[model samples]
Target: MNNKLHGPLFLAILSTLMAFASLSTDIYLPAMPIMANELQGDIELTVTGFLIGFALAQLVWGPISDTLGRRLPLFIGMVMFIIGSVGCALSTDIQQMVFWRVFQAFGACTGPMLARAMIRDSYTRTRAAQMLSTLLFIMAIAPIIGPLAGGQIIRVTSWHAIFWLLVVIGGLMFFSLFALPETLLPENRVKISLANVFRNYSMLLCNREFMRYTLCLTFFYVAAYAFMTGSPFVYISFYGVDPQYYGWLFALNILGVMAMSLVNRRLVLRYPLENLLKVAVTVATIATLTLALVVKLQLGGIVAVVVTIFLFFSMNGVIAATSTTAALDAVPSSLAGSASALIGSLQYGSGIISSLFLALFRDGTPWTMSWIMVIFTLSSITVLLRRGPLPENRSSLN
Candidate 1:
């Protein structure tokens, strides 16, 4: 990597790009009810639409980035994102909102997907892990800030302002992105073709070590997104938490993420990544189980819900950085884009499932959220422990 592109500013730009997905979703979450009442249809459509676009678009962006190099595909995606954001801000009905949300996500997915490839292009395994941790640490700030700022914005203005705010963010980040050097060298680039894309992805799908980590990471994301999809309604409508105060509670969970990210950054130096991952998974399982127990027994009220959710969400700090690094490390450098796309596509794709689960089984309580989290957490743990390649055997397996 160029020295000019390996400083704080470089990390900031990459992290900001990565934050686009979370920023676009979290900022409008507090105002979802307002949007729903005014728009007169299922507001969950916005979330589901974004998740679908985010999930599927990465497949295209990843291959295109690999072929064309990262910068061109990235700039094009940002332009799409900007146009979509403007459309969202001007939407007159739920149908239009859903369309633009999907469009916005099509562009938004490029940021994180390509950012991961860029990181892989720059560093080896351990260094990549550390840099990813640091990237996540910076990126975590968006979730902390988004809902808080969103809550205040909705108090005085319509939810349209929220999309406008996203437009401004997209514009600024689009310009800031120019400073990032193209990490994928020309000599390393591959040709873009449907057959080529299919073959590369097929190769990744058959790699046991790669699939294990990717699947585990995808499960964790599903669990967390399930919570995100349902929490606003659970907290505000069910528990009567004020919308303005929702972000404060949300920040607590994200703070847990930042704290755990820092811890993972240090622990990676002294501990095997597998060990760190195991412990994180165990802790996450326990937290979700406890949350289920709390919500079932009604022992902790909202206090218990927040604390347990905090613990469950905090493990994201370790799980996301470590699992992603591990999965990417299992593949040849040429496959980084496809690996990232596969991982991202599945992770976000599961959100649609989570959203549908809540939509169908929800009973106006927190039970559906808790159940989905538990199911996915258990699925992740099972994959990591029972199916994942053993540490000593990973080299041969990959």
Candidate 2:
């Protein structure tokens, strides 16, 4: 049965699942202003709640998927996503919307966390790395498609339409999983106990190499979250770009990231993935620092800021895809779910930090986001490139 989960079919399942997870955020982003008024909540707070839900959900779901096997947990996830989406549509207040959003995020998170675990289940380290990139490359299309479609959805209907679309997507994924075979074997399964879950996570936390890649991935991820959280207001309010045009600008950065992922898909087999990741981290650091300087100097206006941002985001595909590959590859196969979940939890934890930072320090200028990106990118570089020979984690693919 697992053999059937081998090729394009498997990629499609994971990408579709990931697409929905991504859609849960990307699609809803453009509608934030309308939502602020109708749902009666602060835009930043709503976004923060949803992202926090999205990240925190993985902590529990990952271990559950590990304990129960992928199928039951994933099935439960899809159902919850549907319910959450539906509940969100019916919400009359912002609080209700936030609650439903948290629920939806929990369900939506199953996609990426389990997708990584499933890849580990069936593929070797290098192949798993390549597969993850390919999955992300496919998932990358969602950001382009989501915001564009979301903008159109908003023009035609209300923000509630976004949730309704999510409901339909959730339904399709739930039914689609019928064909997804259980990838985790009985021997690999662990007991579903609280102590066991903590132990599983604590082991990954203790592993220096595993923490290296995971934290690096998480820190680098904060820049992306900050951009998403802050860009709407920056573009719409500060730059005075039309809401419709904002998605295109957003899509431009997303397309750059996608292009890099495609490049990684080609190079991943030929180069040592870790080396590629290091190079990516280095490039991202420089790009971010340059962006920060540009903001500090107040040079080139919004166009310059956007250009630097695109460059900064372009590294996302190369760094993130490669780092995730390295992180999971470094872990023992048995702890893949736990490792993936912790990675996700930290990833979103940084997202929470990014949101709070934006809320606290934003002064109607892009300087704050620029410095924040620089800070996070530097953190990743420091984690991954400390002043010693890097510890050998996985055997070299090249």
The candidate that achieves the highest lDDT relative to the unseen native structure: 1
Residue 101, candidate 2: alpha-carbon lDDT: 81
TM-score, predicted candidate 2 vs. hidden true structure = 0.94
RMSD score of candidate 1 (Å): 2.3
Segments in model 2 whose C-alpha atoms lie over 4 Å from true places: 191-194, 387-398
The TM-scores of all predictions, comma-separated, are 0.97, 0.94
Residue 188 in model 2: lDDT: 81
Q: Number of clashing residue pairs in every model?
A: 0, 0
Q: How far in Å is the alpha carbon of 260 misplaced in model 1?
A: 0.7
Candidate 2 clash figure, as a count: 0
Full-model lDDT, candidate 1: 0.89
**Would you list the C-alpha lDDT of every candidate in the order shown?**
0.89, 0.81
